[model samples]
Target: MRHSQADTILQDSMAKRRIKEVTDAVTHESPVKKHLENLLENKVELEQVLAQNSNIDQLVKAAGRVQPNPVETITTIDGIHPVVKKKSGIKKSQIVYDNDYIDVDYDTKNQPFRHVEQDDCKIPNFANTWNAIVDMRQSKKAPVDTMGAHCCADETQDRPTYEYQTLVACMLSSQTKDSVTAAAMDTLKQRGLTIENIAKMPEEELDSLINKVGFHKTKAKHIKQATDIVIEKYGGRVPNTVEELVKLPGVGPKMANLVTQLAFKRINGIAVDLHVHRVANRLGWVKTKSPEETRIKLEELIPKKLWAEVNHLLVGFGQTMCVAAGPGCSTCAANKWCPVGRAAVGK
Candidate 1:
C-alpha cells in the first residue's frame, strides 16, 4: 500500500523507537551483547587510528595501547571470572572472550542479584545483628559471663589484686565451656588460688580441682609451669602485652588477645575461638580455615572501634542462637537477614 509522505515519516520514527528499545534491553540484559558492543566500539576506534597512520610500527604501538577500561580476559575454566573475586571454592557463571567471540558459560543456578561470597559484598552490619540477638536472648541470661574468666577474676577482691588469677582463668578457659571453667575457678578460689598457693599446690591436687574440664591434667601442668615462670620472671605479675602474655604456657592468640582486653583493658586485636571462626565464615564475613586466620582477617576487615565488641557479640550470638550444632534458626533474630540462615532454611 502506498502511504502519504507524512504517514511514511511517522512510521519510520516508530520503527526507529522500537529498534532503540530492543537495543537498550539487549545491552542491559545480556552480558554477551554488552561485550560485543565493547568489541565493536574498539574495532571501529582501531580502524580509525590505522586509517590515519602511515607507519606500520606506529600503528602497532597504537593498537597495543591499553584502553581506559580494559576488558578482563578470562583464561581459566574453573568458573572464576576476573569481574569480581570469589571466596574459595565458590562457583560462578561469566561471559568470557573465546577466539574473537563471546560465550556465556555461567552456572545458571546463582541469581545475579542474590548475595554470595564476593569481595565486593558489603561489610556485615554487625552492630544491627548484635542488637537483634541481644533483644532475642534478653529473656534468658547469656550462657556465660559476657567476659568469661575475666569476670570471675574481677570478683575475687581483697586478695592482693590477683592479676595472675585472671591470666590463669583465661588460660584455663581454652577449649573448656564457660560453666566448667567457672566451676574450676571456684575450686581454685576456695583453695586460695594465689601464686604462693598455686606454686605450693601439688600438681595432683590442681588436677583434681580442675578435672571436670577437658584436658584438665595437661592444663594443670601448664598452669603450674606458667605460674612458676610468672613468679620467677615477672615478679608475680601477669604481663600486660600480647607478646608477653603468649609466652605463658597453654596460651595462644585467643587467650593472649582476650586477657589483654579483659584483664589489662587493652584491645590489641580480635579474639577468635571456634565459635567466632565458625560464625564469621557462616556470615560470609571472612573465609578462613583456622581461628588464627580468622583473627587476622577480621582485624583487617572490622573497624578498630568494633574490635572489642566482636568477641562478646559473636560469642553470645553463637551460644544463644547460632550454635555449632543444630542452631535455633527458627527463633533466631538475625535469621531473616542472615544469608547462611536463609540458605539453610531454604528460603
Candidate 2:
C-alpha cells in the first residue's frame, strides 16, 4: 500500500512479460494445438486411404462427402475375399467376384481398376447361329406354319375380314397350342364368325364354341369387346401398328407384334412366345428370364429386315427340333453353335 512509483512500474513490467510468455506457449506449443494438428494429419491420411480403393472411397464419399485426393499409398485394408481357385490363370488376388472363368486383366497394385476379356458366354454370335437355324427350318413343317396367324385367311376372303381373323388367331394363340388354336379358328369359321355375328353372340355361347382352347371364357369376352372397338373405333379394320393393336383387351406385346406382322404385313417387333423363349435360350441366342426380355433382346440383335422371318423360323425350330421336354440336339444342325446342345450331346 505504501509502494513507490518506480517499484510499481517494475512490478507491472514483470507482469506483462509473464502474460506474453503464457500467450506464446498457448499459441505455438500447447497440448490442445498439437492435438488439433494431429487430428488434421490423421484426416488427410484417412482420405488418402479411401482414395486408394474406389469401393471404400465410394462408401466414404457416400457417408461423409469426402473428396479424397489421388494417393500413391494405400494406408487402409479391403474386405477379406474368399480364395477362389480357377483354371483361367487369373491372379487370385485381383478377382473379388465371380468371373466365370473369364480372363480379366489384373492390376497388381490397384484393388479397384480391372479389365474383362470378351467371352462367348456373355453374348451370342447371332448371325451365324441365325443362318444355321434358317437352314434347318427348310425341311421342317410345324403346326404353326399351317395354323399360324398368317394362314388364317383363305384366298376368297376380303382384306378386312382376313385381317380381323388374323388378329383373332394371334390373340387366341397365347398360352394355347397351335393345334388347339387351329381347332378354335376352324370352329369359329364353321359358326360364321362375321364381326356382326360375333359382336352380338353371348360370351357363354362363344366360350362353348372355343371351349377346347386355353382361357376360352375370358378370350370370349375379349373377342367381343375387341371386335366392338375395331368396328366402332377403327371402322372394322384391325389397327395396323403395334401401338394401336395393344390397346384392345387381352392384347399383349406378343399378340400385337404377330398381328401387325401377319395382318398388316408390317414387322414391328419380334413376337416371343413360350416356344421362341425356350429355343432362344436353349440355343444361347439370348440369356433372358422372360419372353418379353427375349423379344427386346432379339430386336436388338436381328436386323429390321429379318424381323418377320425370325419368329417363324424360331417357332418352327422350337416345335420340331427344340421341344421343351426333349430337344433333338443330336439331329440339330445348330447344335455345333449351341452351348446347351453341345453340352447335352457331350461334344
> Which prediction has the highest TM-score against the true structure?
2
lDDT of 2 by residue, 1-347 (tens): 12243244234545335433433344222222222222222333233333443333242223332222211000011111113354333332433421111121221112221112233123456655666676676667778777776666544688888888888888788767888888888889888767778888888999999888766776888998999999999988887765566668768667877776666666666678778989988877788866766776776665555555667777888888899757998988878888987898888
The sequence of per-residue lDDT tens digits that candidate 1 reaches over residues 1-347 is: 12243244234555335433433444222223222222222333223333454333443333333321212222111111123344333222433211111122221112111122233224666555555665665555565534376566744454334677878888788767898888888889888878889999999999999998766876899999998898899888777766566657677657877776666566777778878988888877788866766776787776555566667667767887788765776777777667787777776
- What residue runs in model 1 are displaced by over 4 Å at the alpha carbon? 1-124, 154-160
Clashing pairs in 2: none
Best by lDDT: 2
RMSD each, Å: 25.9, 29.5
Error of 1 at 225 (Å): 0.6
